[model samples]
Target: MIVCKFGGTSVADAAAISRVVEIITNKQSEQPVVIVSALGGATNLLLDIANKAAGGELLSALQLIEQLRDRHQREAQALLGGSTEAEELSLDISATFDELAHLAEAFRTLGYLTPRSLDAVAAIGELLSSQIVAAAFRHQGHPAVFVDARDVMRTNDFFTKAEPDTDEIRQLAQARLVPLVQQGKIPVMGGFVGATASRVTTTLGRGGSDYSASLIGAAIDATGIEIWTDVDGMLTADPRVIPAAQLIERISFDEAAELAAFGAKVLHPATIAPAVQRGIPVYVYNSRNPGGKGTMIAFDAPRLPVRAIAGKRATTMVKLRSSRMLLAPGFLRRVFEVFETHRTSVDVVTTSEVSVSVTLDDATNLASILQDLAAFGDVSVSPRAGLIAIVGAGISDGSLAIAQAIAALGPIPIHMASLSATGINFTLVIDDDQVIPAMQRLHATFFESAS
Candidate 1:
């Protein structure tokens, strides 16, 4: 059996869903388990409705809920075409929307949104889409079973960013999904939505559908996990940043993970972990161009000095300097402790005898963090920083790749640089405005020039 996940755009509307149905029909022989994201933009709309209601705009929230209800109903009608299944699905959609209205009323009464309440609202997108897709499959004469993800995807009550219980997931999946596959039935489940052990609704945060697919693939020990999205595959650089960015036919799991971590939006950062643990090959394909040979992420990709360049902006650099840190034994520990207390994650770190500099992708707790760090030294922040990373399996073998990267940068000032402990990722901190141009230049030097 294999696990196949389709992104939001691949199942955005009736036309998009038709394409997905066709793709799944062709893969039926493989005993594929399907995972789907919410219809495109549905999650965002749901979030908006939740916030509006919490902010005392119940009428507006209800109006948006009705709009969403209409969309799902329209899509289902187009797919099922006045069939009994269509009528049933319409009722289901209406019931779900009615529940949303009730939730909005509660939020308006409370005049605030808790994380758990927000997750309840956020999870509706996947729930509604999965149900509709499964019904459509049945209407098309395929024996597809709608499996509630919360039934198998057991997770902790982390609310907005719930973490899955892999052991529980594996056991539940074996008990729930294996039978359907054995009986020649396709199991369709919503991605990104899971439930706590006590049956409380929870979400795995944004970009979690891919993570869901990986977890399921690992649980079932499937032959492969396929991520179907709008793009062709992983590229040497983001195509939006460099039009000349070339497609990478294959990449190692480590290289792929590094790219995702640094800023490659093609795959979620956590998507590779479970697949790597299970030694499962992950495939990225364009749902629209089903016949195209998309990128394969495995352990056997060629070891090149640099396989891809990834960049992300909106970073902030925090620097602390103190003469007391020259040889302090626990100084570094205390410095990091402050950040830990504030629940802030530090990305890149560079240190000198008297100072430490780190980058933060999330600065929500910056003010509190800085106040805490003041005990250690002079705390300073440089906002609007950017990070560029060159990732490959062979980066740690020698210094040549690093030399090329530095040479490509030319006059662009670098605030800091750090090579990963594994030596596969070399990152540079620069001004946010330079991220795109630097990535373009780096791509040309490493990819285009050689081509």
Candidate 2:
């Protein structure tokens, strides 16, 4: 059996869902376990409704809720019209939205939204979309069973960014999902939504649908995992930035993971871990053009000096300068504990005898983080920085690739640069506006120049 995950665009509306049916129809012999994200832009809208309600814009939030309701109703009607399935699914969708409305009302009355409450609202998108997709499959004469992901995807109580419990997931999946597949039925579930041990709804953060697919794939010990998105495959650079960016036909798991971590939007950074552990090959394919030669991610891919360039904007660089860091045993540990406490992830780092500089992907708690860091040293913040990473397996073998990447940057001011401990990633901090142009230059130097 293989696990196939369809992204939002793959199941956005009637037409997209029909495309999904065709794709899965061809793969029926694979005993495909289908996972789907919410309809296009559904999750974001759901989040917006929650926030607006919390901010006391109850009327506006209700209007948005009705808009969402009509959209899902239209999808259901278009996909399952003139059948009993249409009525049943419409009621299911209505019930879910009604629950969402009540939650919005509660948030409005309370005048606040907690992470836990936000997750409760966010999970509704997948909850509603998965049901519609499953019903659409059934309407089209497929033996697709709608399985609530929360039933099998056990997670901790971390709320919005909850981590899955792999052992529990494996056990529950075997007991709940394996039997369905064994009975010649396809088990369909929503990605990115899970429940705590006590069954409280929670969500994995944004872009987590990919991570969800990986987790489910590992639990089932499936032969392979396929990620269906709008893109053909992973590219040498973000196509939006470099329109001439070429596809990377194949990438090693290590290289892919590095790229994902360094701001490659193709896959979530955590998406590779489970697949890597189980040695399951993962494929990224464009749902719109399933016949295209998409990228394969596995261990056997050849290592190269530079495989891709990835950049992330809105990075904040934090620098702490202190003489206590000179030969200090636990100074670094103390410094990082502040970030840990604030739950901010440090991306790239460079250190000197008296100073340490690190880039952060999240600055949600920047004020508190700086206050905590005052105990260690002078803390400085550089907001709206950009991070560029050159990822490959061979970069660590020598500095040649690093030298080339730096030279490719021409005169762009680099705030800080660090070679990762793993040696697979060389990252640079620069002005936010320089990310796209810098990525284009580096892509040209490595990928385009030879061609």
Candidate 3:
């Protein structure tokens, strides 16, 4: 069996959904199990509706609901064309909208939106999109079975960012999805949405559909997992930053995970873990250009000096310095405890005997973190920082590769640089404005010159 996951853009509208249908039709021999995200921009619309309603703009929220209802109806009709299944889906879709209206009323009554309530509202898109995708596949004469993901992906009640119970998910997948596949049916599921053990609605965090795919792929012991998105595959650099960035043909699971964690958009950072546990190979492909050669991720891939360069903007850097840390044993823990208390995530770190510097993507808790750290040592905060990462199978251990990177980026001012603990990622913190030019230079040095 193989797991095929299509992203939002792959099922965005009638035309895109049709392309997905064609892809599935051709790949049915693989016993393909399909996973789909919300239609393009559907999740954003749902969240907007919920926020507007809670802010006492029920009228505007309802109006947005109307627009969403119309959009889904149009896409469904264009795909299924007045069939009985289409009619049934229309009712189902309408019922979900009704639930939203009721939820909006509850939000207004409660005067606050809890994480659980927000997840309840956010999950509607995946639910709706999966239903439509299944119906469209069946209309095309394929025996597609739509299974509500909640029934299979049992999770803790963390609500907005629920963690999946893998052991339970494995049991449920074998019992629920295996039977359908054995009976010669295509098992279709929505990604990124699950239910708690108690059956309360919950969501995996944003961009979690890829995580869902990897988990499901591992559970079913699939031979391979395919992530179908808009891009050709993982690229050497962000195309927006380096228009000439070339696609990487294959990557090790560790390298891919490092790139994803740093900022590659092709796959979610969590996507590689479960698949790695099962020794499953994951593939990334373009739904639009299905014939193109895409990237394959596995345990052993050919190592390169530097395979990819990934960067993210809007970062903040924190520096802590004090002589007290010179011979301290638990000083690092004490310093990090402030971040933990505020629930802030530190992205990169570089340290000396008496001073430590860290980069952050979540500045939401910056003020609190700084205030708490002030009690320990002198602290400096720099906003508008950015991170650029060069990923390879042995980037940190490869001194020549690191030398090449520094040589390519010598003109730019780098605030801090650190090699990851596992030695797969070499990250540099710089001014956000230098990201594009730095990426261009690195790509040219590593990829273009090689070509």
Candidate 4:
């Protein structure tokens, strides 16, 4: 069995949904299990409505809901040809909007939007999209089963960002998914949405649809997982920055994860972990060019000298210095404790005998984190920092790669540098203004030959 996940763009309209139908029809022999995200930008619109409702703008929120209803209703009619099934599905979709309206009213009365309430409002996008796609698939004569993910993907009561209970998930899939596959039925489920054991609605965080697909693939022990999205595949550098950036044909799980974490848009950062642990291969394919052989991610890929160069701007660097840290035993530990206390994640760290520097992506809590770190020693926060990572299997062969990187960088001043202990990634810190140029230079130095 194979697991296939289509992103928002793949199912955004009737034409896109038809293309997905063709993809699934071609894979009928593989007994594919399908997962889908919200139709493009629907989740954002839903969130906007939720926020407006929380702010007591019920009329504006209801206007957005009406627009959403019309968009989906039009797509439903176009795809299903306005049959009775299409009419029934339209009512189902309207019911979800009704629920949203009711929730908005409740929030207006309550004068606040809790995380749990927000999740309840947010999950309707995936729910409605999945239902529409399933109906469209059946309309095309495929035996498609609309599996409400809430029934199979059991999670803790975290609401907004619930963590899945793997044991229960595995059990549920083995019992529920296996039979559906045996009957030669294609199971279509919603991504990024789940429910507690008691059936309370919840969601995984943003860009979490990819992670959702991976988790489901792991639970079912599928042969492989495919993520169909808008891009061609993973690229050597951000195309917006480097016009000549080349598509990466194959990458290892670790390399992909590192690139994603550093700002590769092809996949979610957490999407690779569960699949990597299960040794399942993931293919990133283009929904536009369904026939194109996109990037493949697997275990033990051939060692490339440098597979990709990825970077992220809008980062902050924190530098801590004190003579007291030189002989202090738990000084570094204490410094990190402050970040933990503030619920901020540290991306990179470099240290000397008496000084330490760390990079953080979450700048919202910077002030509080700086205050807490100041209690330990002198702390300085540098905003407008960026990080660039060179990812490949042979990144740590020697100091040769680092030397080449620094040479390629030329006069672009690097603020910090660190090589992963496993040697799969070499990261450099630079000013936000230099990130794009550095990525372009490094990509040319390493991947130009392949390009």
- Using TM-score, give the best candidate's number: 2
Q: Which prediction has the highest lDDT against the true structure?
A: 1
Candidate 2 lDDT over residue span 1-451, tens digit each: 8999999999999999999988998998888999999999999999999999999999999999999999999999999987998998888888888888998899999999899999988988898888898898899999999999999899999989998999999999889888998898988999999999999998888988899999999999899999999999999999988998889999999889989988888899999999999999999999999999999999967788898999999999999999989998989999999989998888888999999999888899999999999888898999989999998888879878999999999999999988888788898999999999899999999999898
For model 3, residues 1-451, the per-residue Cα lDDT tens digits are: 9999999999999999999999999998889899999999999999998898889888888998999988999999999997888889999989889889888887777767889888988888888899999998999999998999999988999778789999999999999988888888999999999998889989998998999999999899999999999999999887877889888888999999988988899998899999999999999999999999999999888877688999999899999998899999999999998888887779998899989999998898888898999888899999989999998876765489999999999779999999878788889999999988888888889889978
Instruction: Spell out the clash pairs found in candidate 4.
Output: none
lDDT of all the models against the reference?
0.94, 0.92, 0.91, 0.89
Across 211-330, the per-residue lDDT of candidate 1 in tens digits comes to 999999999989999999998999998999999988899999999999998999889999999999999999999999999999999988988999999999999999999999998999
Please give the TM-score that candidate 4 achieves against the real structure.
Answer: 0.95
Give me the displacement of residue 325 in model 3, in angstroms.
Answer: 0.9
lDDT of 4: 0.89
Per the 3 Å backbone cut-off, how many clashing residue pairs does candidate 4 have?
0
Backbone clashes, each candidate: 0, 0, 0, 0
Q: Is candidate 1 or candidate 3 better by lDDT?
A: 1
Q: What is the alpha-carbon RMSD of candidate 4 to the true structure?
A: 1.7
Runs in model 3 deviating more than 4 A are: none
Of the two candidates 2 and 4, the one with more favorable TM-score, higher being better, is 2
Query: Tens-digit lDDT track for model 4 on 1-451?
Result: 8889999999999999999999989998988999999999999999999899889999999999999999999999999996899989988988888888898788778878898988887888888888889999899889999999898888998777788888898898888887898899999999999999899988987887898899889999989999999878888888888888887788889899999999998888889998998999999999899988899998867897688888999999999999999888988888888888887889988999989999998898888888888887888888999999988889788778878989999999999999888788899999999998898888788777555
Stretches of candidate 4 off by over 4 Å are: 449-451
Determine which window of 10 residues in candidate 1 has minimal summed lDDT: 337-346
